[model samples]
Target: MPISSLARSITGAGRRFPPPLARDPHAGCAKPDRNLPPDRTASVIHKPHILVVFGTRPEAIKMAPVVAALRARDGLDVSVAVTAQHRQLLDQVLAIFGIVPDVDLDLMQAGQSLDTLAARILTQFGATLDARRPDRILVHGDTLTSMVATLAAYFRQIPVGHVEAGLRSGNIYSPWPEEANRKVTGVIADLHFAPTPQAAAALRAENVPGAAIHVTGNTVIDALLAMRDRIAAQPALAAGLDPLAARFAGRRIVAVTSHRRENFGDGMAQVAAAIARIADRPDVGVIFPVHPNPAVRPVMEAALGSHPNVALIDPLDYPHFVRLMAMSVVMLTDSGGVQEEAPSLGKPVLVMRDTTERPEGVAAGTSQLVGTDPDTIVNRMFALLDDDAAYAAMAQAHNPYGDGQAAQRIARIVDDAHRR
Candidate 1:
């Protein structure tokens, strides 16, 4: 199918899935299916049902690897349920993987508040669980969708395996609701998929049972690696991007992306200003893919739009984004996924956020947290540009996350969880 048609097909198919439960008929009855076939039969067959829930683009990116891993297993039935918190972006990831979600909540709305999102997730989730009632729920990272889904599962005592768990900024308000969401989910989660030793340590410090925690590296790196393979298979896509990729050919391209709700007005303005300053440099060019969010578009267009060197285009697909990351000299953005991805590519990242849950990257010297202050962002960008040795040191630092087998490891853990 054509890319445009695929997008339409997925969106049209997605609407048919039911939303989170509005009424709970089976919330109390949702329980694990604890049945073992005869010893000989069980050895050959006894597929465990694992329900994976994610909504945003980041979540989708991070979870795709896990979904692939689970599907590849000998005895596991994997079903993906996307809440469609990010709409188009979410669908793009799903379409790329060619894995249609078994259930899509289609929860996005214009001018929707977080409260409405939470309530809708709760209502709809209650109903979904009552209907499907999988053996285990696998939720990735922290988002309102994950938060609500984890809570709903917890209420029924459903086992939740939290991928990329134990990430912490400590300060609850720094990452805004996310810090709280992850911590709370940590309390309710049965298995914690910690991406780094630091993350595992945090979970340990929290007194979460060591038996429940597994150091499975960040699944995003696995997805990035997989995406690179996919991109190589379709070299035609690389044709249109070659010239632009060549413009960033030998030289570094600073792959930039910023669009967090906390950084909408003033924070976005500061991010734009930082890009403008970077664009002024004769040698270094900024490649910022503008997000579709209206709040982000105007500010980005107003600041970095018409710049001679800065290439502001539409948001890239997962594969394009990875190729760009591999070509980048340094990454500048507030995105959490970038923090994890850049380190694996040996690229140094300058985070625009004031706080990050992925402090493992910073501790590993792979990333620098330069808050939304334009001056701080500019100065750091220049420092990295001017000092090659400093740039190399940061870029070459070992990624603390994982060795990129996170998806496989998570699949094994989920299988083990089901047997018990």
Candidate 2:
């Protein structure tokens, strides 16, 4: 569906879909005696309202599939709310997925600190909860936005369902605030949609009741598969990468993404140094979608801006990014989504972190952990670039993240819970 049409369908403006069919509350029960009394004859049916909330690009991307699934089902009224923490980046995913958020907090501001953003999301979303009065609120993963949004819902005693829950890195500060944010959400979230057996096990270890945890696959794979198919049919959707592909036609391309807070000053510089070493090769070229954060963009540009074989460009949109992944020889990123996504495309991911919450990929042989050490990164890059056997071993391994039906499972679970 087009963005406008989807928005209209969500808001009941144009009504592209047919009205929901009336459901009988007592479908399987025996018919009541209408002649004796009318009170027993009539049945009351109530549709539970669910509010889905997210903020930032990753949250938006992961939640897009869930929104589509929930909206397509009957007996549930689903509404989307975006905190817009990463304003421009969040909107890009929203457009690609054709999701029209029923309530947009528009909370992003110049140089907004963490505490300020949290305060705004809590205050504004508290008001939203009061006005919308949804029966439950669904939150995704661990962003400051997710944690704060979950808190807002908790304040009102509204039940919250957490998607991609039960990720733990042991040390909360290593992945910075994310590890802590997810753990906090795990405490308040009544319905835990864990992506892997490992994640479910982690939740159980924490004493989160086993009944609340559902082992649905990660939704990123669902989004990735859907977009991959879309691009396959409509090649023009990702045509923006033609020039970059042409520039490095004869050489193998390495797609890179890094913007972790742990890898800020020294870590980011070393990463640029590693890329510089790899780009020095005559047979290799690097395509890095430099993040726009002041802490990151300039550091990378200073180290690699003038390199002939390096294309340090702005972030590509969804389809274009998918195209980058499809054509690239190896995936290099610190992104949690990339770890799950690259393996689906048969791309070996060299995770740029010492520890990862998604350890299934490492144990499954789809990826390897090569932290921010310049020497280690260079060695790993060269190993994959020079040897086919090493590359194939990682590429051929199974992607344990998902099979592309997570959103459907999540929608069904939510619908069933609401029916109760």
Candidate 3:
């Protein structure tokens, strides 16, 4: 079978997947109902309202599965809200998932500062929360939008359910405001849906009540698996990737994605330099979905643009990216979600960051942190390319991030909590 068809078979779209086992390694919380509905006695009461909020493309990709799961349940009334922090990118994911946000704050500006963005999100989102008056608010990952939106919900006294929660890099400034954003959300959120046992342990160490934290796995896998299936079933969904697929035919393709704010200056230059060196190999082809940010685009294009084997194209939509991942030999990224998703596709990932909050990937042997050092990046890339055993080890490692049933588990947990 072709690679795309094989991916479809693995995903098993339109069929129900088995739920993740309700075993919590942290030993603080009770086993949640695996597939049970809300308590029958509480059915007479009104269905709980869940307002799902996200802004950036990554958040939308991770949160879309949770929103779909909540919408599928009978016990929950689900609504979506987007801050549009990354307007075009966010909309692309929303369209892929067919999610129509109940509110769009349109918070993006040409050259907005962090302080200004935070203030706008807090103000606009606060009013939206007041008007909608949802029973609970759900935020995904760590963006300025997630942090400020959680604060808005807190001010309204509405409980916040944080998806992909409990990630910590220890150093608050390493990932810039992301570490602080998730930490702030962690401190304020009422219900935390941690992606791994390690993440849950981090929450426990911080004195968060065990009952409030549930190991639901990461929702990014759910979104990834779904998109892979869709792209496979309908090849047209992957049209954006066809040119690269044809261009790199019979060659080892390395998919590259690096756009973290911290990797702006010297870090980006080093990454570009590394890619230039990697592209010199005749057998390898590099497909980089260059971020449009002024900090990244100019540096990357200047460094790698003239290279025939290096294709630095515009950012792709969800389906297109999934297709690229499905076809690639390996992935090089600074993206947290990519670290998690690539392992599931049995693709080895070389992380470009110095530190990562998703240590579960590294511990599981599915990914390695190469940082932004040009030598480090190039050496790691060559090892994966030249050493068959090294590549297989990382590709075949267990994906600790998820099993694609995270959204279902989160929906069931939310239903059970709302009834109480």
Candidate 4:
């Protein structure tokens, strides 16, 4: 079937699934099977049900590996539910990963506030939990979807397994609601999959039981390495990047991505100005995939759109984005996942945020925080462009994220928990 048709079919079929809880949550946790042997052993040998939930693009990217891993197990029944908080972007990642969510909340609405989004997710997901009643629900990262989904499951008395938990920026408002979202999920999740030792320690400091936390390296690396390999083998997958590759030719490509809500107005303009200035160098070229947000697109286009060497294009798909990172000499971004991903490809990163929750990249010397100050961003971009030694230092540093076996570790952990 055509991709577009398949997507429509999935969306249409999703709505036909039983609406959230037509019955009580605890009324019938399990359905009887008349064909099964009438013995205690047979009754006890039922497969465990695991429901994995996520809403946005980042959550889908990080959770795709876990979903795949869980599905590969023999005694587990896995289902996926997507809130589609970011309808188009979320669908892009799902298509790339070939994930068709069993339940599509379709919760996105124009100009919706955080309170409304949270209320809708809780109500709709609460019904989903009652209908599915899986043994456990797994949520990923720090989105509002993750937090409220956990709350919904908790209300139904179902356990939540948090992936990429235990990250703290020490300030609640710096990263806005994300820092608080992750903290709340940490409080409620039964299993915490910390991406690094530091994250695991953070959870321990919160007085969370050490036994519940597992340091399963960031699944982003697993997704990155896998995508990189697939792109390498099937070059057509990265055909979208071919045009930019031809356009930049011999120039050093500086790939940029900045759309953090914290950097909305002034911060965004400064970063755009820096990119415009950095493009003045004849030997360097800038390829920025402009975010679609009104606050972001206008500033970026007004500032860098006229630069001859800068190409301000729409957002690239996952494989194209990975291909862009692989082809680039450096990356500048305020994204959390990029900090973890770019390092694996040996690309030096200059963070556009003042403080990062994923400081593992900074400590390992793979990424440096330059904030949104145009002067600082310009100076750092120049140093990486002009000074080979400085660029090499960051490019050659170790990626502290993972060794690409995170999904296996997470799958084993979940299986062991179920067996116990």
TM-score of each: 0.88, 0.90, 0.89, 0.91
Tens digits of lDDT, candidate 4, 1-420: 111121122221001112122333233233445566787434334666788999998898899999999989866768899999898888888988999888999999977889999999999988888777777888998999999998887777677888998999998986988998999888888889999999999999998888888999999999999999998898888776666688889999999999898999889989988888889999888888776778898888777777889887777778888888999999999999999999999999999999999999999999999999999999988998889999999999999999999988999998888886
lDDT of 2 by residue, 119-196 (tens): 999999988887776777899998998899888877777778999998888988869889989998889888999999
Evaluate residue 295 in candidate 3 and report its C-alpha lDDT on the 0 to 100 scale: 93
Q: Write the per-residue lDDT of candidate 3 for residues 286-360, one digit (tens) a residue.
A: 888877788988898888878888887777788878888888999999998899999999999999998999999
lDDT on C-alpha atoms for all candidate structures: 0.79, 0.85, 0.84, 0.85
**Ten-residue region with minimum lDDT total, candidate 3:** 8-17
Question: The CA-based lDDT of model 2 is what?
Answer: 0.85
Residues forming the 10-long window of minimal summed lDDT in candidate 1: 7-16
| Count of clashing pairs, candidate 4 | 1
Model 2 scores a TM of 0.90
Candidate 2 Cα deviation (angstroms), residue 301? 0.9
Candidate 4 least-lDDT 10 residues? 10-19
lDDT for each residue of candidate 1 in 330-412, tens digit (9 for 90 to 100): 89988888988888888999998877888878888999999999899999989988999999899899988777799999999
Candidate 3, which segments miss by more than 4 Å at Cα?
Answer: 1-45
| Residue 168 miss distance in model 3 (angstroms) | 1.1
The candidates, ranked best first by TM-score, are 4, 2, 3, 1
RMSD of each: 6.5, 8.5, 9.2, 6.2
